[model samples]
Target chain A: MKIHGSISKTASFRTTNAVFIGRSIRLSLRNAEALIMAIMLPVMLMLLFTYVFGGSIDPSGNYVNYVVPGIILLCAGFGSSSTGVDVAHDMTNGIIDRFRTMPIQSLSVVTGHVVASLARNLLATAVVIGVALLVGFRPSANALEWLAAIGVISLFILTITWLFAAIGLVAGSPSAASGYGFILLFLPYLSSAFVPTSSMPSWLQGVAEHQPITPVIETIRGLLTGTPIHDSAWWAVGWCALILLLAILWSIVSFNRKAGRR
Target chain B: MRGNVIEVKGLRKKFGHQIVLDGIDLAVPTGTVYALLGPNGAGKTTLINIMSTLVAPDEGSVKIAGYDIVTDKNMVKRSISLTGQFAAVDEMLTGEENLRMICRLSGLTVAESNVRTVELLQHFDLTAAARKSVKTYSGGMRRRLDIAISLVISRPVLFLDEPTTGLDTISRRALWKIIDQLKERGITVFLTTQYLEEADQLADIITVIDEGRVVATGTAKELKSRVGGEVIELFNDKDDLIRTVSTTGSIHDIRQKLNELASIVSPELRVNIRKPSMDDVFLALTAKEMERSLS
Candidate 1:
């Protein structure tokens, strides 16, 4: 794969893709009611869990601290469903064909959807975190660790968003994108997210131990607890990297197939 | 040979066992409106898709604005825009936002996008409903907005696949005027239409496709001339009128004396010499295709 052209040309593709993604984010924000509604889901989840389920979970010390990171990660993961919906809406509405004929980069369309989800995810995450602090949740780690935590979660959300966008492209309708959302919500619940896997059934424990969500939740938990970083962080990063790569590959393949038929 | 902006040679496409376009060739010169006339499922959309670079050909090559569609895709895309049979516009966004987004996609800067959006809104006469969400707009308004978005990039070549499919007479004429203005700016317009008068009004050349192959290609007059100089339907009292018509060499037994005459003219002294319309030629060509297939 010769990238082709001079340095300026390479820079131009990145610039064009970024601008396109920025426009998508603006459009997403313009729908104020929908944006607010989407953000409310994660915040509501945090509040409900802290008030209702926090007493039962045993994670040493305050349950809010242990539960907050998991909820934030859940927000990042499930928040991407709307991105899939947007892409599906574009497909059903006949907008994708117009983009196919343009001079824009191939990845720009998927990136725009992913970035739009990222922007919304981050906003929702911030609202959830702020609400968490208000109700008594604090990280023992320093500023650098907090930033690192954010970086990991952002990457996680972006990767999942791309996968959902691909699923959205293949989905029959916008509402079906939310059907995938249910499966996303199941991951955090089944993993060692809100509770210890020791309390789970012997058969269920196998699932909680091996699922990708376990490592991700454990890694974020380790970071906020200021515990000595474990191999789980590396495992979480590796799993995210693999999923992102597969999703990127699948997106390009589906895009090409759609393009061929046009 | 005549500074053609689009040249398609032996183009072909297929979906599994179904062949869509089979060895069809066409050339459209710069600043000319070439109307591809076909009935439903006649592969007109497939041809436009291939030419617009939305779809790739199974065989043959397409050149648009002197750029090969496959090898020079970006350059080809830079010079052309397509409005397919379905008007593609975002219902959530206002008509103006749709146009502005297209400008941005075309690589216009922020300031340039604003200017282009305003210009397109005014040109499409969509300025009044510019702020209205497209979901609230009428079908005509949405269709008009779709076309206006295509122009924001100001490409030299434009493809419209049945632009006036389900429009009222008034809306159809409005679209025609916009197309005429585009041609005045020296844009090469390639369109496909089922409405015969549309091709008659707009096309410099018309190509008829049937069963995914070019059955006929020429100017409207050239094609019409092929059937006959004039068709005289007589309501004569004479039972021997058939003989009277047959002697003139212009009247062939269309129902029975089925020799295909390339061109016909009545040699009668009082011959009515009215030129045939494109509609008549199209009907004849498609009828022949049906007849051939049935046999």
Candidate 2:
């Protein structure tokens, strides 16, 4: 049959991506128990750190207020890695080869991974946010500021998710993809997540002070507390932009590599 | 409609130092099944992978449905679907959802996708198991679902890489029937198989590839013809047989000598002139290669 030609190229691409992303979301939702298990890890971490260790950390406020933003970032990092795992599983099962021969937009592959990652991270982020409120981690900011904070965090989730998806595409096995998540978990701890930078040793503090993640955390923390703009906010925005750009470039290159396009 | 739909010339691929495909050429016509038969490590899969645009050839040009696979990759990809030997269904999805996913990937709208999914499920006889998760499906069921998923897109050209490799007899026959139906619909099928019987049953054209090169190409009849027609299998005791043949003065030599003398002679020890089969053809081709190597 002669398929419709009236659909514009952009529309076709967008539609294809939406369909694939929608499929991934459906599959994930169907396995909601496993998904909830994924979310519970970060939620448990938030509870443990905020309530048990709340008094020991001197963050000039309740420990939940100090650690909740970091936990939210942790949720994003942990949850986004599932994209890689799922892609790896697809590769192992030969589903990727099936897609390779079809006429679908190549961008749909990336979009599917990113969208699914965002959806999953959003759920985990929601759970963390909910638990934070229950534990007295209310943000003093207005609604718009809270939205901005969530926006930046989601963007961070998206950028990192795409990067990990690419990694999973080239990974030799599913185990490799899941195991790689541990590498990303170490980044946030080195940032201003748990304690103030001054509390760390000088050399370690220097390393932590200049890392890209510290600014992201600080920016979210600032927005939550309704603090004014600081030099760190500019640095945070720069880091996020750089990460987003690099992730996109890397993903495109890796996709072409996987398909042997070049 | 029977003209060549896929044409490859001088295709070559190398992985580091090992060559996979070496200067291969092929032509597969529309509305027919073309079987590329080869043993393992013979570059059959690599050639299919290249033709399907899954891998780039180091040197060569390929055209599918008149579109260049490299420059017009998207267009070429649009006209084809591949179902690999392994099942490609998503384990988390039901059998029906897997086919629907492929329909969506092929740019079908939601309503269209559902229609196509139902059509494919019914065609593959998976309607009863449509709602069962693929993770719970049997091996044969999953294989059928995989083929069904590829067809959900309903492209004009399909590549089946050993579609029946591990299937049971009944499932294999079912798949063959489905493939026959596809050919009746004028879809060009490019398949690779180790099963000589499968090739004989399905291929309108057969290309025998070995050691990264095309050893022969023809209809089953033409390839079988290469093995010659007459045979004399004497079953006397070894020495007695030799003595009898010697006393009989070598019928083949006698026939050849008589032909040179412009006379016809018929050999008499109950000679058989049976048509050669595909196995005979394969042996002849490989035997010729062995002789060439030895010389």
Candidate 3:
């Protein structure tokens, strides 16, 4: 075949990024084990918390509404960790080396994982929300409030997905990456995701109230229940932006260092 | 160097305290197959990596298709494609999808990418398995797909690092045929291999590296000549048929020795003279180096 004309840099860059994104999404979906991990925990936890502990935890008797926001945030956090495992697999499997040798944009590899993780997290969140709705969870959210909640949740997914993607690159193997996921999965447990922060001992309460996940969950709950977002929404946004910036910077640095070696 | 597609000067690299490639140099002319022959840990892959710009050299420079490896990396990338030791194919994707992804990444338009993907699948004899996931592919199919992906961009130079390391004989021959076709299309191929037969069969010029240094460089015949003169093979049921004889003198003296041997041994013995193969040359050169190092 003839050597066709070379594509312009901008066009090539966009096409490469699109191809990586599509490939990553397809691969992630086809990975049955990772898909089960991403979906199973959130569904199981929603059922357990709504049915087993609802009466004692929420004496006011609307625990489904109380736990749905928390479970959505938890699902997002857990779903994003799978991005780490996927990235680790890519790094160890020599595909990253192939990509590095190609003429495509370097950042597109990481960007593709980030975008795919976000898609996965959003899907998991929807699944949890659907289960919650089936279990009699209702929110008095208006269209604008629901839009705002989605924006906040999307930002949270973006931040956590990037953070774990970097963690995956630093990890030596896929199993090691899953080990790192434990920290992320357990963070929601200590946060206000399951119970109000004040119910904990004073020292634990401080951490549960102030960590990034708590404010994010609190903001989503307020947005859904028509409560004033107040400072918690801004704090959640700030945390997402700060974590995203740091994780992206770290991912680039680690990826370059790793890719430079033989 | 003027007509070379790949030129290297004093290239050096080391991993920590161990020297992998010690002040190596190479020059490959356009449209020729150049083979780098080495034993394991002789730094063949390191050299290929440096030339492909996958790993930077500790010292010296490389020019690919007239573009500096350090300063003109994008141009070097535009000119060369590397199929590494591992197949480097995405196991999760189907063979067709893998080719399509590479084509699109290489800047082909939608229709062009589709056509090129199909053409490459057919060329590599992977059309039947095109729809199957690479995870289910055999080692040979993965290797063919890897080379096919590298060819998606149609660069002037291609690097194959131990491309046939794990393939069966049939697959190895299939790959060699494909490589021959590439040469016919004027594509310069730079391959690193431990198989002496592979180098002898494919390379127009072969460089043998041992213990981080190039031990010898030349055509297969030239290398054999360096080790010694022509070998005489005598076939007989008796034990006295094998002999090593020098050929430093005139043809008259050689004829006299052959006649003398015929008179002494059985007249029924069959004698033939032939050049040494690459295996002999490689063993002789490496053994000499080993002895020198031990001393």
Candidate 4:
């Protein structure tokens, strides 16, 4: 079939992004099980930790203020991991093959998943924050601090989402992607998100204090409570930027490798 | 050759140590159905993938719509569409959404995309189920939707790799009708199938491949001729009356042979003669290749 006319060489960046993002969001919304896990798991954890162990864990009489940041980190971590599962599903289901053959931007597929995951995690974070407020959590931050907190969280979400999306592309199955999520979910627990790193055992404190999640949670915690904005915020930004850079490169290389193979 | 939409030369592909496509060559003219007939594991899909730019060939050159598949891939992609053996439609999206998404991705404006989506839904008889998610669609409906998605921006060439592999007879015939319409619209079709009957019914030209090699390439009739002419069967209860004769003669000659056999053997013997079909051609050609390879 010889088409007489040539296709426009101009790539439609907007249209391609819209198509992929719309598809990703629509598909994620339909997966009720994944949505419930991404949203409700953090809410349940918030309720359990605040009501059950709030007083014992934080005798400072302001447990909600401390635990809310931790729960928000938890929500972001768990929600980003779902991006991997979605990417894995797309890879194994042959949609990736279809996408590869199209004239659209090559990275739009991964970008779509990353953007949708950011939206989902932000929404989940909002819900967690709402629940925390309802449970008597209060922050001393001003409007700028709140905006900075959101900016920091969004960056963190973007970084982790890309990282896991890469992992999902490399994973053998959706179930395996979920298994990879457990590693992310466990990070906040080991970090200072849930408690002061000083409270951890002397042998374990070093790890708990230095991991990526620790600096991020501490930054969010400091932002929310009007604490001294110190090196933790810069460290968090650096980690996010580094992870995003690596993840983007890894994802592009892996995606090309996968698409290049028969 | 100037009007050919697909030109493949010495096309070769290897998976690890196994050569899946062994230096094959082909040319598909514009607005014709070129059927690739092969048994399972004959590397039909590998060939399609290389042409469609989904996989890279280890050796050889493929030019689709006058664009080299390796160096000018985007041009080749913009000029062709592929429907794989599996339905590649997104199951979570509605049938309409799927079509519109593909249209939008192809750079169609929203209004144009919507109009095209509706037109395709109606054309494929999917309008009734357009609002339902593809996960709810039957195999036939999904296959139609998958094809519909590929046609969102009708390119010059379409590659259908076993498009009706698992479809029922009715669905298969329906897909064939759609493909025929595509050819009528001046779209070049490159189809791969294991069904000899399908190739015979729809192909303007047929290429028979086996074990990663092209065994024969010609029209269905031309291929059938390669396997010899009509078959004559003589049957009877008496063992001596039975004869297996292969001849390329007229019905009159067949009747005369049966009459001569009847006089010599048993008058009760029955004779049946029929044209050699694509099935016979496929079997004969592939079997020949297998024998030659073994020897």
Clashing pairs in 2: none
C-alpha RMSD by candidate, in order: 6.2, 5.4, 3.6, 3.2
lDDT of 1 by residue, A79-138 (tens): 787878877777665566777777777558678889888888888888988998998897
User: How would you encode candidate 4's per-residue C-alpha lDDT over B1-295 as one tens digit per residue?
Assistant: 2488899999889888998999899989888999999999999999998899988888899998899999999998888888887888888889999888887787777787788888888888999999998899999999999888887777888889898888999999999998998988888889999999999999999999998999999998898887666766777765443665555777677667777777787667777777788877887788789899899
DockQ of each: 0.27, 0.37, 0.41, 0.45
For residues B1-295, write the lDDT of model 3, one tens digit per residue: 2399988999899889999988888889999999999889999988988887778888989999889988988778778888988888899999999989888887778898899999889888899999999999999999999998988877888899999998999999999998898898888999999999999999999999998888999888788788566655677766564655544345775687788888887777777776677877888789888999899
- Model 1 CA lDDT for position B15: 82
lDDT of 4: 0.85
Ranking by DockQ: 4, 3, 2, 1
For residues B1-295, write the lDDT of model 2, one tens digit per residue. 4589999999999989989888999998888999998888889888888988989889999999888999998888877888876776788889988877776666667787788788777877889999988889887898889877776655778899899988899999988988898898788999999988888888999999877888999998787666664332332333232111111235675466444433322233232223456876776686676687589
Which parts of model 1 are misplaced by more than 4 Å? Answer: A1-11, A57-61, A227-229, A260-262, B231-277
lDDT of each: 0.78, 0.78, 0.85, 0.85
Instruction: Output the number of the DockQ-best candidate.
Output: 4
Docking class of 4: acceptable
Per-residue lDDT of model 1, residues B104-159, tens digit only:
66766778778878877887789999998888997778789998887775677888
TM-score of each: 0.87, 0.88, 0.91, 0.93
Give the DockQ-based CAPRI class for model 3. Answer: acceptable
Off by over 4 Å in 3: A1-11, A227-229, A260-262, B231-274
Residue lDDT tens for model 4, A208-242: 88889988988999999865657999899999999
Chain B TM, per prediction: 0.86, 0.85, 0.88, 0.91
lDDT of 4 at B48: 91
